[model samples]
Target: MTTISNTERGAAKVMNRTDLTQRLVARLHKDEAVVGGIGHTNWDLWASGQRPQNFYMLGSMGLAAPIALGVAVAQPDRMVFALEGDGSLLMQVGALATIATVEPANLCVIVWDNEAFHITGGQKSLTATGADIVAMARGAGLTNSTWAADEAHFESLVDEALGGTTGPRLIAARIDMTKPAGTTDRDPVKIRLNFMSGIAPPDKEG
Candidate 1:
């Protein structure tokens, strides 16, 4: 495992999810696949710009990383990203260990840790008190996991993950309690078809 710098959660800057989402979208030049978790995470992804390569999880809470893992494993040539909330991630924490075991070099999981379940009446989550996601990720055997120190640091980490040949990188960012920019189109069929077309090879696209 490569040794990347780990930022302490307390020392990390609190940022807005919408801003960070836009920043991440702006950096994707190569048709990378991004699986956005339910609610706010997918809303920001939709607002960022509707890339056909983006998959929005409508009802599922904790399947973003697992879905992205499947995409990463299937499309080894392309980069894959999973945008998940801290609460959702905790719900499927075992995915971290599964990802570590599979070791997909093209996979990168980014957790938006606002420390609350923003969509569900903003209830405080485990992260609000003492849950450390990065530490949990490390314990799950994802050695490349780390807390994003700030927005700039987050971008640099994204760049490194995109360029480097490593397995299952994890980045946790402390986010603010800001609302998402927009709501995603709720057409599950259209979302699935578009994402399928987006990730397909040119010859396979309709």
Candidate 2:
């Protein structure tokens, strides 16, 4: 009956995404870590345009999962997580099937299912119940998935999901995107160029 309540009923910690991202990134600080998503931080990282340790998502919301998959496959020793949004995941739902096949233990997919595209406007999305997320991921063949209703539970889930278990895990979180962090303005052309700099084909001419 309640929509997007901070229920805090799970064992995972509820965070404002960037905070969680900072926490997780801190955990893997020493290693080659990559956080792919669509938004301000992403655009910032993309504008910086560094490779190996930096990957900014360009077009498509759901593609971050697949992108992280490739990064995990190509660089098996690195740490990769997808800071995905619920709206974006709705765009590329099928890519999840590939995730199950790849099964990169180091891969962690965190969906900040705020029920809207924060970067755009806090408009309504398909995640009216937050049901669209957890249900879809479970059905996509991914195991070790959980949803966090509060901050404490989210932290715990992160620990369990990333502790030592084999992954392809999804953490669906419902949040309120009202606390403005920043804008979603980025140099798209520059992002494309920077992105290409990192993963250019061997035979491709620049």
Candidate 3:
């Protein structure tokens, strides 16, 4: 197997979260489960398209990855994704280690590193000062981690991850500070019901 280091991925491209989210959404054909982290992450996922397989986190800061991890573990055959902001992921960095320990082949984590808390005031984040999330993930044992250098590369990584390359995979996308186009519906109960009902096996009736 050929191994590529994070630096080998090339210089990180500053991208738009909305575009990245749309790219990710367009590639979903297998009813993949997507967990959106709080604020901008879910907002972009919501703006892209609201599917039953998409779960939007309302108030939680750093739970998207953990929640996706659970979903991936429960449904071992389904592709699961977690879209989280850099600040939120920093809040729960330890989750990366936990995900590595589980070693779920179907789990993919995407961190939108905008270098600031875009949802709140645009405060400078650790990443702005040169923190490398992909490196941190690799250190935490998610060796498949890589930084997406550009849009095409991002699509390729997403395709590979969804195609069942040994995961849990983590992709760190350096993004711009533009605001999301829309907001997610603030209904946690409906979100939960819909996501659960969506991921339910086709043969099983709820």
For each candidate in turn, the TM-score is 0.96, 0.73, 0.95
Q: Pick the candidate with the highest TM-score.
A: 1
Output the TM-score of candidate 1.
0.96
lDDT score for candidate 1 against the true structure? 0.94
Location of the lowest summed lDDT over 10 successive residues in candidate 2: 1-10
Clashing pairs for model 2 are 11-153, 12-152, 12-153, 12-154, 13-151, 13-153, 13-154, 13-155, 14-150, 14-151
Candidate 3 per-residue lDDT, tens place, 63-103, comes to 99999999999999999999999999999999999999999
Which residue runs of candidate 2 sit more than 4 Å off their true CA positions?
Answer: 1-15, 40-52, 183-206
Task: Report lDDT (CA) for all predictions.
Answer: 0.94, 0.64, 0.91
Ranking by TM-score: 1, 3, 2
RMSD in Å for model 2: 6.0
Stronger candidate by TM-score (1 vs 2): 1
- Residue lDDT tens for model 1, 45-80: 999999999999998799999999999988898999
